[model samples]
Target: MTTARRIPVAIVGGFLGSGKTSLLRRVLTGAADTAVIVNEFGEVGLDHQLLRACEERVELLGGGCACCTRRADLVRTLRDLLDDRDRGRAELRRVVIETSGLADPAPIAFTITSDPMVRHHFEVERLIVTVDACNGPAQLAAHPEVAKQALLADELVITKVDLVEPEARDRLAAQLSELNPAATIRTAVHGVLEHEALRASAGRAEPGARPDGRAPPPPARAGAGGHTDDVRTLCMDLDRPIDWLGFAVWLSMLLHARGEEVLRVKGLLELEDGTLVSVNGVQHVMHTPEHLPRAAIADPRPGIVFITRGLDVHRLRDSLETFQRLARAGAGVSGR
Candidate 1:
């Protein structure tokens, strides 16, 4: 028997008062065949109540439902949602998990990816983060979670743009890009972005699923121009394949040494064994590398995008090359 197709889980995460609920409301009002799982219903009673108000606005969900729960019961709640959908009580094509303001999205991501039951039925589609433009700079400087949320995002949405001055908005945008250069960034007024941009921003189309992002390496330039002046971006284009094991070690060391400074790493890598690996990481957490499942892709070209702070690209590239050589030599010696 064929296994049933798994549904995708898209996450909406951000720091407190970052207009998370506003974005969640937009998500509810925008789509159909979507189920929503909201956590920490009582922590900020006002926001939960405000978001719950969306139920009345989403009259066209077509029998899909949104349930609110605390953090601890998320896995169980997900199972319940699946069960309900299976029972014909509702129809769900995708799931959207709106985390509480103070919650760390990585753990939720871990729960979805690590739990055997959850992973079998569900796969993470993408992580969309909302950042409040007016207060983002202060938040990033004061709260580490704010940076984590920005770093892990597939798309970062800047909310309440109208409330902030143009300079502040531009600075915040630069900081976000420096933190997650690979992420698609869009600005919104009251959480509404253009439909096309929003759809693209709510990614998880399978990494490398889009044929358009491939590009020539960018010109090496100035570092991240944030208020803090710590973040930076590096884009690399490769013509040759790489040894997977060596690359893994290089990445492990990079994160192990400066995970806090390395905000995000994302790209397509061609492994020497002829497998194409898609990598995405934030701080110390990494999603398992995805090998293409569609078919044999002939293009073995490699490209990598890094978002980091306090590290230069040239050094990173040199160290990686050295490790690859060392690893190959070690393998040869062992074979003898």
Candidate 2:
């Protein structure tokens, strides 16, 4: 008989100096026998060696983020870990991947969720991101990749808050709220949080819990730009319901044309025909369109969040609406 699958496979990601390692150290100290995959960008993985106690089970795949140059290596390493558990050499309970600070979380996440073998043994419990409170704002202003990390996280953790002034803290919180209003923001000092709340999500919805706790409330209004330490995130909310077929067509074209730059697209769309679709995409690949089992009719306004590198929001909005309008016009004629 096959053993039951486990939960609590978390991804601890953040920009450089965002306290990712510090958080992992805390988790490992408490959760024993947990499997960890560490990816480092430097030639020498000194950080991996630093975690002395976890040496035996910890696997290091240093070189770059697994999604870019070392994707195959990542797949192979995970395969080996699965094999070990089957052979009874190690009893693995949970898995955590600490991504490089500059890495794009979407591709790494897509691999885990899309791969057949890995999906069977592991499920993505949640993505936890650490924000360097002192410098997060400046970083987002300069680096686009950092913005991607903030947007993709399920939970946003503000690290090194003690280092910054209270004024800076307020600004950082406001900026983070704008960038990833979707994720729950928690402050951490020396990397400590209540385990139940920190890891409460555990890759499963407890009884009627919704993922990410309902759709991110829409941005107050259309914004020109929002900046973090290194990148920017643009949010747009449609005042009226959207035409589903047209939205699909526009999304397909957008992905085909700018997939690499498009890190992630997640939104709740109200269809013209009265059904609702929760659509999410990572780079060029998109998850099969997921229809909500029930309608969120109370909130009919469609909301869209896009994480991209160096894309003009105004231009994108124009193109998307144009495609949507064309699609709807065609549908109207067909109905007659």
Candidate 3:
């Protein structure tokens, strides 16, 4: 039997006054088939009221942040949206969840993926995070949540660029890149970015895929830019095809042991079957791995990037290599 199509979900997250609602307002204008779930930390949800003018299907989760106290409400709201779509009461092609300013996006992702019913009906398409150009530097230095939000994003939108000087904006962009080397960075003035750029499907590309067909140079070593909280980005290149079973075991163990410290991981891996798989995870929760068509990728070298806190890159690399070697040796003996 064929599987049913799942609704794609886009998560919009950032710190207070980071222009998330403004960005969402622009993206949702004239979007008839999209439903929105807006979370606010107070008893009254003012953001949802502003958003209702742009889209018809808007649900509010008031009185708590979506990442923690209001998580169950989020799940209920999503299931309710699905019910509306199923009953023909709503025509929904996509769902957007606007997390509260102080929300942690990882738990919201985990809630969707971990719920058996919800996971079957919905898939997280992308994580879009906004950063204030004026206050982003201080926020990154002082608030661990803001750094986590930036690091976990698939696309980082630097908002209010006009408020800062050109040099300051450039510096903020560079810092975001250092925090998340794999994410695509864009700038917005007055929360306005090209509509196409804000689309859920626009930013993701195969790791190291370039216009010239040459892999881009590897990211700089961690700590080179002196990031705060010991949070650093690490990039690793795969020299050979990886054994899938071994790779799975290695990742499972790593996340199980040090999940909190490993904030995010993104990679494209070449497996022993000569197929390429894309891996993405936030904290301990991983999105389902995706298989890529061989014809589409230009650079065949497999690469992985990690945004981690207080973790040694060398030790992590060694652990992965050791597991792969052991798996290969076991396969050889079994073959004989």
Candidate 4:
């Protein structure tokens, strides 16, 4: 029997009035093979209504926010999407999870990776975030959620650029870069982005390409330019394998304790057993770590890049190192 192809999930998120709906509309304008699962906080899902394709299976999640309180609902909806596809109810080329304006991409993404039922069926293909040029700067400055949205983005599309002045646009672009140096930034008009840009933004990796969910770690960078002026990005390179169990426990605990401030965590860790592990998270939701091919794998340099709010990277690195050491010592005891 042929193995079923796993569907890719593209998560679209942004702050309130950030043009998320408009950009989603553009993606579905002519793509008949695509399907969507939209989480609308209101009783009525206007985004689903706007999608005119009769064949497109658009599931609307309303009442509470999908990324937080209603996150379990999202997992159920995704399973349903896969079931429908398996039963020939829908033919889809791609699936997009359009989050509510107030949503964070983390929890939903965590649901996708963390759940057993849908984990193998769906891989997070991309996280696209829209920033309204007119209000993006102010939103980034005044709202922590806005920064979180941007920090979690794989592609940051600045919409309504025509409404803002050139200088303002540049400033916003720079700020976004500071927030997520790894994300590709683009300007959009009327929520329309270039097809090439969209394709690039998705990274469009084949199933095995990014098995670990680690996008190329952003270059080593350190800055405090965004609002709160506390979001610190720390990048590191490690040449040794680590103790996976201990590191996982420690990192998980760290997120539990300081999830609000630990915006984005991307790391490529080498295990003591000579395996390469990719570990990353957004806020409190850690993506399931993946083990890569061990024999002469490409891009073997283990890198950790973080975009955080008031996190002490030095302390974090030291703690991680300590955990790995203890884990190794325990493992040796077990072997004896």
Looking at model 1, report the run of 10 residues with the lowest lDDT sum. Answer: 53-62
> What lDDT does candidate 2 reach at residue 158?
82
lDDT of 4: 0.67
The TM-score obtained by model 3 is: 0.84
lDDT of 1 at 133: 83
Tens digits of per-residue lDDT, candidate 2, 113-155, equal 6667866666666678888888887777677677767767667
lDDT value, residue 141 of candidate 2: 67
User: RMSD per prediction, one decimal?
Assistant: 8.5, 6.9, 5.7, 6.1
* Better structure of 3 and 4 per lDDT: 3
Predicted structure 4, TM vs. truth: 0.72
Ordered list by lDDT, greatest first: 3, 4, 1, 2
For model 1, residues 206-232, the per-residue Cα lDDT tens digits are 232542225424624423224335555
**Stretches of candidate 3 exceeding 4 Å from the true structure:** 41-70, 194-227
TM-score for each prediction?
0.70, 0.68, 0.84, 0.72
lDDT of each: 0.65, 0.62, 0.73, 0.67
Candidate 1's TM-score reads: 0.70
Residue 174, candidate 2: Cα error in Å is: 1.8
Q: Write candidate 3's Cα lDDT for 73-124 as tens digits.
A: 6677787777877798777788888876766787778778877898999898
Q: Where's the lowest-lDDT run of ten residues in candidate 2?
A: 49-58
